[model samples]
Target: MGRSPAADAEFMMRDTTSHPPAYAPAYKTSVLRSPKNALISLQHSLSEVTAPVFRADELGPLDNDLIKNCAKDGLPVGERLLVHGHVRDQLGRPVKNALVEVWQANASGRYRHKKDQYIGALDPNFGGCGRVLTDENGYYFYRTIKPGPYPWRNRVNEWRPAHIHYAISGHGWVQRLITQMYFEGDPLIATCPILRSVPSEEQIRGLIALQDTSAFVQLDSRAYRFDIVLRGQRATLFENHVQGTPQ
Candidate 1:
């Protein structure tokens, strides 16, 4: 029989050794500020607990479509976007059955969160969050709008680039990764301090999804492909985990 609900919760809460390392040293900005700081010493240790495995029955068909829920009245206001990609492990093997979650600001540069002080009008049709599981080939896709840039107090007159936030969890909880996906050809990409913070240009380049004109429809929306490799081929075991977006 499957593990009881309470038992599964306990397993997820416990630490496991099978998972990758906790935080990456290169992402010091995120590490320093994260709650994990309290346990920095143990961040690199193998875990004794593992993330709970998700049952196929628990996920629904509409979960992967961000726009479907809000389209009851009509399609949300914005250019329709189709983002698709593959998830792979260090050895270039597909990490199937993974859960991927995404959220972003609406096209007007405003988020639904109450704390978002951006003055742009909010769209009643957009909820701005979605989730999907990887297929047998470790591929996932979603439909969303092209989010707009938003101003923040990080610096004087600073505005973030158009991007979507992503949270990925492979078979194990310890394999979880949180990062942001940026659009190609956006001028803001060069100036974004968060992106520049990454030490290697190659790694930074991986974060930007390139535009695919072949997928574009006349008078319709464009397409972007962003393939994610969970860990690089030469990367030390668990050395690179999450590259969380700086909120």
Candidate 2:
């Protein structure tokens, strides 16, 4: 016989302990940003679960290539990288056609935004953003430069590790998930206040992308694999949807 709906749901239920506390004291900013009241669970309305269909034609041919998408004079100066991964649900099923977006600082660890006062210089040719939709098998890849680390005011002399910010949307508005991806072997990962906020060492490791030498482009770019699991026992730590699992 087949498993019941309740059984399947139970199997895919996320382990609350896998996620970090919203108000981690070490991550100072979370203090005021964390929720102040008890949480409430509600059923999703049709509008929240549906609509906002994505189409391949909506994306430009260069939308997935950050290296050239924003180039005006020449290629951006930095270590070229090819990041690829699979998007899977808690049940290990491929999440086909999911929209994945990524943005990061330039090689000097400076954002293109005007509010950023970091001393690092910005690359004139790099926009530091890109997006791509997953294929039928849940595969997605993009090319960009590896961002550098930079200091933050979270604590005296505190430095954030080099990382990429990701925003993934499944089927609807309610399915949008946001997270960060760190590179493996970065010593700063162990000390970053934001990363240390995560309680589980295993889950912390999940956020780090592994270097994939096999996928490297000869003499061009190095590759890294950072697969994402939407929810369940091994869900990737999403910053936005911390309280409950998304349907």
Best by TM-score: 2
Put down candidate 1 lDDT per residue, 98-169, tens digits, no spaces.
Answer: 888899999999998998888977888898998888899999888899999987766677778999999987
On lDDT, the candidate that comes out on top is: 2
lDDT of each: 0.73, 0.84
Candidate 1: misplaced stretches above 4 Å? 1-49, 217-219, 231-247
lDDT of 1 at 131: 88
Candidate 2 collision pairs:
none
lDDT string for model 2 (1-247, tens) is: 1211221222233355867889888899899999998677555455444435578999999999999999999999999999999998777878778889999999999988999999999899999999999999999999999999999999889889999999997654455678999999999999998888888799999999999999999999999999998753223436765334674
Q: Give the clashing residue pairs of candidate 1, or none.
A: 15-48, 15-49, 16-47, 16-48, 16-49, 17-47
Minimum summed lDDT over a 10-residue window in model 1 is located at: 2-11
User: How displaced is residue 178 in candidate 1, in Å?
Assistant: 0.4
lDDT of 1: 0.73
